[model samples]
Target: MAGDLVLLTGSTGFLGYIILTELLKHGYRVRAAVRSQTKAKRVLAGPSIKALAPTDEQLSFVTVPDMTAPGAYDDAVQGVTYIIHSASPIPSFGDGEPPAQDQLEESLVKQALKGALGMLESAHAKAGGSVRRVVMTSSTVAVVPFEVYMGQGTEPDRVWTSEDRIPVAPGPYGFEFQAYSAGKAAVLNASEEFVRTRGTAFDIVSITPSWIFGRDELVTDAGGMRAGSTNSVLLGVVLGVKNDAPYGGNAVYGPDVAKAHVLSLDPVVKGNQSFVLNSMMDWEDAIAIAKKYYPDAFAAGKLREDGKQPTMALKWDASKAKRQLGLELAPFDTMVKEVVGQYLELLAAEEGSK
Candidate 1:
């Protein structure tokens, strides 16, 4: 198992880089699929990846410029024992205006579906004899309906689980989040269907995580640390940036989610199953956690206690991940400390530099 080769997509992304490091740490050889050689170089030069110092055999790169293109992964999947397809389009949260409905559908929904299906097709056709499993990176948004996640109508009284499935919401999606949610859900459903119907040699293990947050070692500067990742959504709370609508209080530590993906690769773990990874979190808890751990920051006005991010609790049954993957999901306190602690550390470094 340690020597087996794994094909990993999205090695340059937030969660993907963590997964890449975890795979190397576990002794699995990685063939990281990057969009370009530049991205591969960036990932290799990253602090976390450089720390591992993976050699050519231990880590390699294959450029698949367009994941949605036909036969995109045919060459990359060869001889690999597993495929971790984490590459997906993310919504832009910048100052620019949101894309039109067709653009959103093309970028978020269509691209996601095609990329996922194409990977599976390649593995099945080219590497079916070698590839034993595919651990896909899904999200809690896939399992939770758009209406429920947006807090639009009556909230479901029941706790959501990996077993739950939501019908794909048709576009003209109102915003990026909704379109992104639809994309994840579509990929999950389509992937399952493909495996179930095709009877491919390999099985699928879908990991559905929510609001992943933790130290992003790839981030080098203060500005990058402040707004570079999903951690930013949580960081915004500590910095007193308010969300127009409260984000659901569902989250999982980045490493824990990464662990889920890596652990699922073991043959002993059941195949063709979904795992929900999350911990219920309160938005305001970040302030308390920060103040309790770093009183000087709040005293110096570097961290605020007057943030207005409201918590919308969304219950999820995540016990299966712990029992099945033998993962102890980090509690909200741990998540808050890690995220806020990293921000403060970066801020201090920046201030010291000046």
Candidate 2:
């Protein structure tokens, strides 16, 4: 049923925020698992979702501070019919040194795998018969190998499915790219192992999205750069810190990604499936579209001209998500315009307070 009880992790994150609202708007009773009860309340109290007017019975919060801890999600998983595991740490570059970078990568990959494995084990062992499915948030890095996406090789037009093996990180790739890519790839590898060894009493579906973008209504501070991994890039552009046009990469709307997670729970959704999603627009063209709608904000001195750096075309197939999940992806132009508009408002608010 569409109104089933759902437990959503990472409820205070950029994409998780949207997913939480989408679940509530669609009549699902959500028990959000966040790191802090106070922060979760602050997020749900934000004006963007206050309009949704979810009743007390419709929304709640559970604190799972350390996802890597043993049985961390046991209580959170209790009485939940579905789980949307969207919480994962974003790898950071420290001092840009190889060793520091290597350390960061190793730590992130290990913790990420451990957290995911913990959630899977908990859902299987503790949820009893209440849980039916788990939809995890993965990155397109898992689908498109870094070596090919960086234009060093002609990556096959592979349709990455649950059956596809997670590609290993190339030895020559940049530190951050290799770290993030390998971390996500490890998630797919772990998920496969979970299904193979843990059995399929509760099916697991992974949604791999490329460079998610959209307005973050919950970010009220000037630290937009810290809001999310992808948002940091977009916010960089908004703040003139990133002066490149088209920004370069496939972008997906946050709401649409949220919808994918929700739809993954549908009864028609098959077990142990993986889906790739993106809006299929170039970063440069997307910025140009945003300039069309917000000329003043994108005017000279604010937004820079195209850097003319060539970008690779999206290589992976996302048709399965559209055909099987019945997702009607939002237009890239509209998404860019809306996202920039909200970003400008945030900048204005920041300026007004200063």
TM-score of 2: 0.88
* Runs off by more than 4 Å, candidate 2: 92-99, 156-163, 170-174, 222-228, 235-248, 306-310
Backbone clashes in each candidate structure, one number apiece? 0, 2
All models: lDDT?
0.89, 0.74
Off by over 4 Å in 1: 95-98
- Candidate 2 structure quality by residue, lDDT tens digits, 1-354: 567899888888788999998898788999988888788878878776799978778898888888899999988888889999998877542212334554655555777888899998898988887888989999887865666665666544644443455566644335565677788888887887787787757888999888787777777654554444466565454444444323225677889999999988888889788888875666556556766777786664455444243446655567888998899777777666766677677767888888
> Candidate 1 — worst ten consecutive residues by lDDT sum?
93-102
Q: In model 2, which range of ten residues has the least summed lDDT? A: 91-100
* Candidate 2 local Cα displacement, residue 222, angstroms: 4.5
TM-scores for candidates 1 onward, in order: 0.96, 0.88
lDDT of 1 by residue, 232-349 (tens): 8788788888776878988888999999999999999999999999988888888888888889988999888888787778889999988988999888888788878878888889
